[model samples]
Structures are given as structure tokens and as C-alpha cells.
Target: MICSSSSSSSRLGWRGAVVVVAALVACRHGQRPMPAPFKLAVFPVQNASGGTAPIRPLTEALDAALGARGLEVVPRGNLDAVLAQHRMRFTGGVDRPMAKVLREELGVDAMLVPTLEQHVADAPPKIAMGVRLVGTGERPVVLWADAVARSGNDAPGLLARGLVTSSGELDRTVVAEVARRVEAYVSKGAAGDSCGDAGRFQPRRVFRAPVLDDVGRRSIAVLPFINDTPRRSASDVILGQFVAQLARSGSFEVLDPGFVREELLGHRIVLEGGVSVDNAMALLSLLNADLVLSGYVRQYVGGQGAPRVEFTAYVLDRRTQELVWSSSSLGEGNDGVFFFGAGRVHTASALSCRMVRGVVDHIVGRRGPLGPAD
Candidate 1:
């Protein structure tokens, strides 16, 4: 897949104000408006500029801009606490499933995700920034998106230009533009024709296995995924995402990973090298589960550019000791109409979420046996 940012003119100061005014006028003409007193959470801006520039300044700027527009902003401390409780980190992309979790945990109406595509502190400071507003709900919706690129006059040793140079000025301008767009979106209550384009970034299922007819409403135990990637925590991150996907699907009763891990540790069983049939059966019996879920992260690569993820998953019938279903999926961090300058982007966590959804949807299909797990 290919990822590209929306092309917006850097000189949007007057244009942004005009848009907001137009939206307010439309509201006066009987158009429904967004409800007042909405709360927003500005997630930590992601650094995808292929550099180590600080992100705190951008995040703080956005937060301040939103607050100045009369929108209630969630405190950074509270947001961080919720993320810590769920063991989640800000990674630029928040899928519908994860968005729902955030809504429940933080009670926020919307989330802002910003990505810094380029930030050069050279003579003529250059910056490219992208921002998206996502509504918190069962299925998150993209409320707005804006991207801008800016650069100052080229000159060697422009350090004499002082700290308040083109870079800082452009940053504030972009933040202000984002804030203006958000206000307009709120006042109009309509996301416009462009909203339909947001689907291009959504995760799509590429494959599906034959439905398992005999599993019925059985409890499932998801073992820790084996990580073949170089990242040491790939397994843990992917496993958590997979379990969350399964839980949200309501396909089978999912056993707690903590409980499953304790049992595995007690049995001195290491699942990194694949589980034998006998050992799988033993573990199934120990957990009193009907099916065992296992997987391997074949590839996981993340960086300043676009992150990519690949994994294979399988479901084994404990009673029959046979592999009932299996599927594999690959997700690219950037994929879409690159020519139009529009593409999906995924962070490591976001890619894992997409991969898990693909695997789970393949196994369970759209409508599966829906009932509380045993």
C-alpha cells in the first residue's frame, strides 16, 4: 500500500477563518450543528519524519489551540493514565475497535491524531504535518483531516534568525488551521463529501476460511503468539491485539491471557517452537477450553516511514485435536491512491490491530455464533 498526505496550502490563516464563519452561517440557516460541551483528546503526535525531532511541542500546541476554541480538552495526565491502564501507546492510527476501547476508558467524544512527516531544523526550516479527527464510537469515523507543507527562504547559517523563526511560526500556523477546521466540523455537523473517502484508510479483510460448524459456542484459549520478527516485544503486542479482536468479535469465550500464561508457566511449556498435539490437548484440558488459538508473527517492520505487519493464525479443536481453521494476512502501513495523495498509514500497534481483525474475521465471518463465552 502507499501512503500520502493531503495537499493543503500553507497560507490558510484567512481561509480557515472564512471557513469557520461560513459553517456558522450555515448553522444559522437551520442546518443541524454538533452538540456543545464536547470533550476532545489530543493524542501524542507521532514522529514519522525519519528524524528524532521532539513531538511534545506539536502536541502541546494542538491541545492549546483546541482549548482556545472553547472545546474541552482531556488532560494529558488523564489520557496517559488510561493508556497505561490498557497498556496502549499512541501510534498515530486508532482503528474502530481501539477507538471504542478509548471511549469507554476515557469518555472522550473525539480524538486528534497528528503525524509529522518532515521537520528539518536547517537554515530554511521545512515542515510537513498531517492531522485527523476521529469520532469516538463503536465504529470510529473520521471527522476531519488536513495536511500542510511549509518552508522558509533558503539561507546558510540562519541560526541568527533566532528561536522564533520560520519553523516555529509554521508550526503554530498549522496548528491554528487544524483548530479552525475542527470548529467548522463541529458547527456544521456534516463531514462533507470528503468523509466518504475516509474508508480508503480502513482495514479490509483479504481472506476467509471455511466456517467451523462444530465449534458451537465454545471457550477459546489464545496462546502467546511466537514472534519471528526482530522486535523483542512483537509477540506481546500482537497477542494483546489479537485477544482484543477476539473479545470484540464475540465469537467465542476467550480465556484471560494472564490465567493462560500462569498455566503454561506452571506446566513448563514454551509455545515459541510450536505446540505438539499432545501438549496442546493437555493445555486445553488444563484450561477447560474447547479451542486453542495460536499464531506466529512472520514479519513486523516499523519505522519513521510506513509500518508493515504479517502473521498467520490457526484454531485447533481440543476435542478432535485437529486444526480446524487457519489463515494469514499482511497489512501495509501505507496503501491507497498514491497519485491522489491519499493513502492509509499504520503504526506498529495499528497494523497489528488490522492483522488481528483480518484473521478473526476470516475465522468467524461477519455473523458468528453470538453468546457469552463458557
Candidate 2:
């Protein structure tokens, strides 16, 4: 997940030129008062410094915010397939020139091209972004563009002490700016008639637990999360919160750490150090678990009366060793400063909880029967 920027390219031409002209003309003629809601796609932001950018979180946040504003967002996976088909290589941020190409190639109403200004993981990770909206030939105008920056401590201590941790506001700031632009574009008639045709402008919802039906209960093993952060205690802090939340959900019969360790010991699985995928599988089998969950706490800070935590998780299928569901979350608190930033102003517990829950629901609930309520 190195944060790298794509090499700059010459000004767009051919298809890019055509799209630009059509877009500007539509704006001038005012053929339609308002364009239809749009189908939007986002490419991952690149990090020039080889640092991991908050790619998924910021993208998800933008999707959620835009969805609230009545725009449709195509799923990232699907968007990737479309882009790959067109043989486009997206290196992190989307510059203006790249946006036009993506929009035309993908046949989408708009493409979000972001330029990565900063992607260092320092004490306060620096994750800055510049965004531009590129439209198709029917809507060539570059509807909007914006840039956002955030600084924080505990980024990840990369490339000397220069790259600290990621800032709490980094992802939020990018999402807000993108949301504002999307809203403005729709209001200014850049959206066009696409939205009117529901089939074209609809987001494909990843079905989670649509319903509870003749479901078979599956046991899950929640393994210890690796501490990828610079802080020594960061892993423990995030671990506590994760286990607590999973326990609260009561979705699966959770195997406590003690139980897992004991099982590992009996099977001579070497529990003295970090757990690998094979070790995790052995433990799962011994515990009679169906799935194994593991992740790493990428950043954590709690020295100056304020605490921050950032972590990621993955649900692995024991048999196939495939990552069925994976996600990342960051939580911060001014008052609670420690203990995983519980109950603080900057805490993302509610939102993070929803995200983790969504992953769980997707994995387990999907296997369950779809209910009428869902």
C-alpha cells in the first residue's frame, strides 16, 4: 500500500478533447435544467512516498456522503474491473488529465481524479488530496475540483522521522470536499439525463445479511491484531475495542484469547510470536471454528492527554486462506486519550462499528437466509 503518485502525462487529446468540448457546450446551451443523478467511480489515491494512503476509507466516506446527496456510486471492485478492461493504470491520485480519460473509457457520468500532494506516514500522517471531476463527451465540462490536507501524529514512522502518523481529519476532509463538488455539479446541470434512467445511475449495493432465515450458526475465531503502529501499546488498545465490539454483536460464538492460546499450546502451534495464516488455520481447526479474523493496528498515539488509534481487519476463510472481508478504521478521542480512544470527540466508534458490522454481516449474514425485513 505504498503511497505513490502517477507520473504526469501530456494534456488530454482525441477522446479527452471531444469530451471537454461536449461538456462545455452542454453548460452553455442549457439543454436540460438538471442532469440526472450520476454513477460515480473512484480510483485509489497513490502515495509518492511509498506510504499507505487512506484509500478505502476516504473513498467509502465519499460514497456514503454522495449517496446521501442523491448521487449513485459504482462499487470500487466493479469500477476496477471496468478500468482494467480499458487497460488504464491508476497510480493513487487522479490528476485532471487522467479524469477525462477514465470518464470516457468507463462510460460513466463522471470520474474522480485526485492528485496526491502528500502521502507520508509520520507521527501525524500527512494525507493531502486534490480532486477534479471529469465528464464524458456529452458532459465534458470539468465540473469541480478541490484539495484537502490533514496533519496528525502517529502516522507510522516511515522514511526517517519525517513521515509520522495519519491525521484524523485527512479522510474526512477529502470526503467533505468531494461531496460538496458532487452536489454543486448536480445543481449546475452537469449531471445530465443519465440519472433519469434509474437503470444507468444506480449503485450496486453489496448485499449483506438481507434477512435472517434457516441459518446455520458458524463459529469464528478472533485472533490478535498485529501492532503495525510505532506505539508499543497501540495493538492492545485496538484489540480490546475490536474484541469488545465483536462480543457485543453476539453474532458468533467467539473464542476468548485464553481459550485460543490454550488450544494453540496443546497443538504445539508456537504461540510465542506473531501468528501467521497457517498458524491461524491450525488454531481455527483446533477450536472448531469456521472463520479466522486477523488484522493490524497501523497507527496509535496516546501520550499528550489525547489518544488516537487506526487499525485494519480481515476475515479469512480458513480452508481457502482467502480474505473474504477486509476493512480499516481510525478512532481518536480528546477526553478518553487512552484505552482505544473510547468516548472522545475525535472518536470514530459509531462509524467504525458500523463498518466492522457491515463486514461481519456481509460474511456471516450473507450465508444466512435473506429475510423479509432485509
Candidate 3:
């Protein structure tokens, strides 16, 4: 669960990717009970990284790497057959029904969902990948989630030897790094850092309502964001980031996004502007969640020059029906870089990660401005 920066290097765009990889790789993950070894299925890699990046090779590499981790790898044919039978196209996240099918039909214990958030295949290649291991059961539960974003020119070193010239090599470096952490989880029962601890990524500003802290409001569900941006999947990306941060914090039970999507569809809950208090209550009951998180993505601009991301999020208590927490955040790829790209972030995904992570921290850690609810 090593969450590296855009400059992370295996040999690494990134300003100091080489140094980052070495340092972040040493960040020890928290300990958990050793999970019983079970068959794992790697879903087809989803390409939302902008442009038409070929994902088949990436998916193949994950399957091979997981197999090398000593776990049984379910064949692609078996997974495709199940998808065809159900007429489902869930490549990003698994819902409860899909997880049930995978468990009963293919005898899989866990599902690995991977999404490519950023990719610049040209020289000085760049990539940002997010992965989550979901255990199959009554509900699709996230066992672990982590992301690795890196560049090929992180550390040039003497004679520029450390520069990664091959995009293929960069791809494998990131994929292998992520998979290695998965192996670490299955073998040593160690997990990585939570989003709140990523010090530099703290929110630009936050406003928390002066509500009494209650332990009862722990479980949460992040509804689909209201995407005002031009990008079609910006909402999805931010939603996933919020969910990942909540799950990794080990503080709240995050409802599986797939289940949330299914319920929203089943109930015909259309989130045109924001989550209505009534709709929030319905979600609380239907998903058995303590809180519902909703948001609006004002702007999400990626690719080309410095990527920019801006969004606002809020949390509602199911029991009290009160707006417990809320925050507005904005970020740029070069938000905090003061020197020589020392801490410069690249890609919209990386920027959004920091933004979403910060918002999650405010909601759980209660470290933002305090005021009355709107």
C-alpha cells in the first residue's frame, strides 16, 4: 500500500520520482490479521486516464503478477462468461450482485479492480493507477485500497541513467509496485497509510459544523457527484477517491459504490442538483449507512498544462438528519511547488486525490473550521 507521488521512480516525469519511490516504499503499512488464502480475480482494467490508452497489457500484467504472488488466478474466459451471462459491464467497481456471482459462479474470494487515472505515454511517460481489493460476500467490502502515480524522468542522476525512456517500462514499474503491496497484504498482513496522513495534500480551506461529535455516525455512503465539469468521468473519479480515503482510514464503513449505484438506479433516485434530505434518508435506510456524502464538482481540467480540480463536499447524518460536515476544495498540479518541481503534482487524478483525501480528513478528523449548519 505504498501511495507514491507523480515523480515516483522504479529505477521515473516526476521531479524526484526516484527519491520518492525509495522513500515512500519504506512507509510501513498497518498490520491486520492474515487473510485466508483464496482465489483472486483481476477485472479488466478501466481506461479513464484520458486518451485511448491500451489497457489489455496492463490487465495482463496484473494477472501475471498476482499469480506470481502464489494465489490462484481465475482465467479471463471464466470472468467473461459470467459477465456475459449477467449482461453486466462492471470493470471499475463491483456491486453486491456482481460479487455474489463471482463468488458462486467462479469461486472467487476477492476481486481486484484497477483504473488508470492518468497516462502520458510519450517520452518521460507518466501514469497514475488506483487499485482496490474487494472481498466477495453479502456485500462487496474493500479490504485494501492504494494508488501509485509516477513519471519516467523523476531522478536523472549522473549521465541521466535513472530516466525511464520506455513507456512500457514505466507501466510495469507502477503496476508491479502496486501488485507487490497487494502481496504484502496477503502475506505479511500489512497495510499502507491513510489519506489524512498525507500532510502536504491538506485542503485549502474547510468549514465543519459545530455539531456534537457522535460515534454512532461512522458508516458512510458517497453518492455520485454533481459533475458540472466537461469531463464525463470526473464525478466518478472523485467519488472513488472519497470512498477509498474513507475505507483506508479504518474509521468508517464505506458502502460499496456498486451497491450504491444499484440502489440509486433501483429507487430511481436522480441527483440532479444535490442529495435531497428525503433522498438522503432513503439512502440511509436502503444502504444501512449512517451518513450520506454528496458533492458538486465545479471544475475538473486535466491533460496539457497544469491540471486543475475544484470541488465541494458535505456529509449528512442519517440519525439526526443534520448536515454534520462540509468543505470546499480546489487544487492545481503546481499548487505547492515552490522550487524545481520539488513537490509539484501532475495529472488531474493526483490533484483530485489530494483534494478528496483532505475533505475526508476534515469529515473524520474534525480539523477544519467550525460553524452552524446551513
Candidate 4:
């Protein structure tokens, strides 16, 4: 009876020891799921050229990826109509204060930024995409990110189908990869490791001067260019062409020339010809323009008996009366008559178009208006 009792006690002790060891192993390996205080507002993917249209496909894909991961996505219809109605383009990182305004105004937690840098219509087509996770602040904290994806042709439609097939599935591949990475990060209880931090836009560094915090929206007016050409008709032609080009850039809220002239008649600036920079500034001040661009057609000569022409344009800062930008271009036409197209003016537009773009590049830097912030 004594031996039996001793054996029972020993067996009970061994069982207890095994249970404790199992509990320790479980404690070492098991992990608690990450908390859900984080929310992301994915930005529309910006194209390499910085146009918004080309990124539509990528935006859809990213939305689906985030959705599958149970991350809430702002609906496209909600913001798309708003931006279009307002004619507002999402200004890159330099608009953080503006974005923070948006966060408070729109009630979003974080901003997810994805950019499509390159899209080549190769055999399967290649898509280069980057994703960034940023928090809400005047300067947002970049929390997490994923690598760029090189996908094939069908990648374009990955977001639409909500699933990918085996053949050339770039979008699907990227979305799946991003979800896996984010999930792993959440599992590890890590935060603030951004995937392509260098490229993200931070507004503070981009703007040359302090921007108005949530400035009330204002309209704009575009005045005609003064023509100094020998031909009287040259002035009208140049100014008309300038107006059309500026409209295409989507930068200015060009007031109707006819309306401006009629309004100016009330103020006495419009004479038989256009107004000078002094009067133009007065007119712009009355019109409440943030900036005014006034310039003259310094030279316009169709090459003698040749299909070529020389054109020179100058821009004046309406307030300071300084030459902001100036450009001269010469082009050759086949008919030996100088039109806006041909030599020097490589783009497809009137000579005035080149001048307009040149001035814009100069004002914004040689990198162009939509370039990434320094």
C-alpha cells in the first residue's frame, strides 16, 4: 500500500510539470493582435507626369487591397465629385497643412498615398506603384509602406474584378503583397516604418512661403497680353492665343476677356489697346487676384518667304513690375511661312503656347509646375 501511494504522487507531479512547460511554450510564441486605432485615407495614385487620370486603375486596386485587409477606404464617388466640382487638384506634400485641414474637415485618420511612377505597355505591360501610410498632423508621420510592384498586362484590371487570375496579374500581385506585408507588421506590433519614405510628399518642404491655413476659396482672372508688334491685329491674335493656352493648364480661373473689358470700362483702364502693367495691377487688385501675369509680344516676325517665324514673349509681375519670365522661340514650316508649329517650338500649339509653358516652368522652377517638391 505504501509503494502504491508513492507511485501515485510521483505520477501526479510529472503531469503537473508537463502542463506548466506547455503553458510557457504557448506564452513565448503566441502574440496578441494589433489594436485598431489606426485608419488610413488612401490618396489617389499620382502619375509620373503628375496627372491624376492615369492612376485610376491603381487606385481601384489599392482600395480593394486595403478593403480585403479590413481597412476602411474612403469611397471614390465621395471625393471624386467633390474635387471635380471644385476644380481642385490634390496638391502634393506641400499641402499638408491643407491636408490636415482636410482631415479635420473630412474626419479621416491617416492618409494613404500611392503613386504610379511608370507604366509601360510592354508585352504584359509593366506598372510601377508605391504606397505610403501617413498620419494626421501639419506634418504627418509616415507609419508603414510596401515595395513597388512590377506586374504584367492584366494588372490594370485587378481592382475591378476584386480577384486576379493567373495570367499577367500585376495588380493582384501587388495588392496581395501589400496586404501580407501590412498584416505582418500589424502582427509584430510595429508602427512608423514607412516603405519608400524618400518619395512621399511633405508640404512644409515644398512651399517657398507659408500658405494660408484653410484660406477661403477665391476666383481668378486672366488679363490679355499687350502686343508691341508692328501689326495692330498681332496684339489681338497673341492675347487670344494666350488665353486659350492658360485655360488648358488648369492653373488659372480665367475671367472672360469681354467681361473684363466691360468691367474695366467702368474703371477706365481699357483704352483702344490693352492696359499697361500699372493699370493691369490696379485692375487685378480690383479683381482680387492672388497674382497677376501681364506680358507683351516683344517680337513677332514671319521669316521672309520661308516657312518659319520668330516669337518672343515676356511676363511681368503685376505688383513688382519685374520680368518674371521671358522666352523666344523660332520654328520652320514646310511651306516656308512661319506658323506656331515647326523648328524650336517642338510642341503642337501656337507659338504662344510654348511661351506660356516656359513662363510657368520658370515661375515653378525648370522642373515644371507639377514636379515633386525639393
Q: Please report how far candidate 1 places residue 175 from its true position, in Å.
A: 20
User: Better model by TM-score, 3 or 4?
Assistant: 3
> In model 4, which regions exceed 4 Å deviation?
1-33, 49-54, 81-88, 151-168, 182-374
lDDT of 1 by residue, 301-349 (tens): 7544456877877778876678877767677756653663344442444
Better of 1 and 3 by lDDT: 3
Residue-pair clash count for candidate 4: 12
Among residues 3 or more apart in sequence or in different chains, the pairs in candidate 1 whose N, CA or C atoms overlap within 3 Å are 1-334, 1-335, 2-334, 2-335
Alpha-carbon lDDT of model 3: 0.72
Ranking by lDDT: 3, 1, 2, 4
lDDT of 3 by residue, 1-374 (tens): 22321111211113223433444445435233233445678888878775778699998998888777786779998889889999988677778778778877887766888888778888777888888777676756566677777777667677889998788999999888878877776565456532224456666667776552554455678898898988767787788788888776656656667778888988898889888999999988998888889898898886656779989888888778988777788888787688877766666777788778777767766422221112
Model 1 / residue 289 / CA error / Å: 0.6
lDDT of 2 by residue, 1-374 (tens): 00010100112334434434455455467543334335666556533222356666665676677777776666777777766775656443333334555555555555555544344444444454545544443212233344444445433245546433445555566567657665665555332111011111111234222222223334466667777766554444334334433433334444444345446556777633466778877777776666677777666553333435466676666556655556655544452246743333322222233334444444554343211211
- TM per candidate comes to 0.47, 0.35, 0.83, 0.36
Q: Rate the local accuracy (lDDT) of all candidates.
A: 0.59, 0.47, 0.72, 0.42
Which numbered prediction scores highest in lDDT against the true structure? 3
Give the range where candidate 4 is weakest over 10 consecutive residues by summed lDDT: 1-10
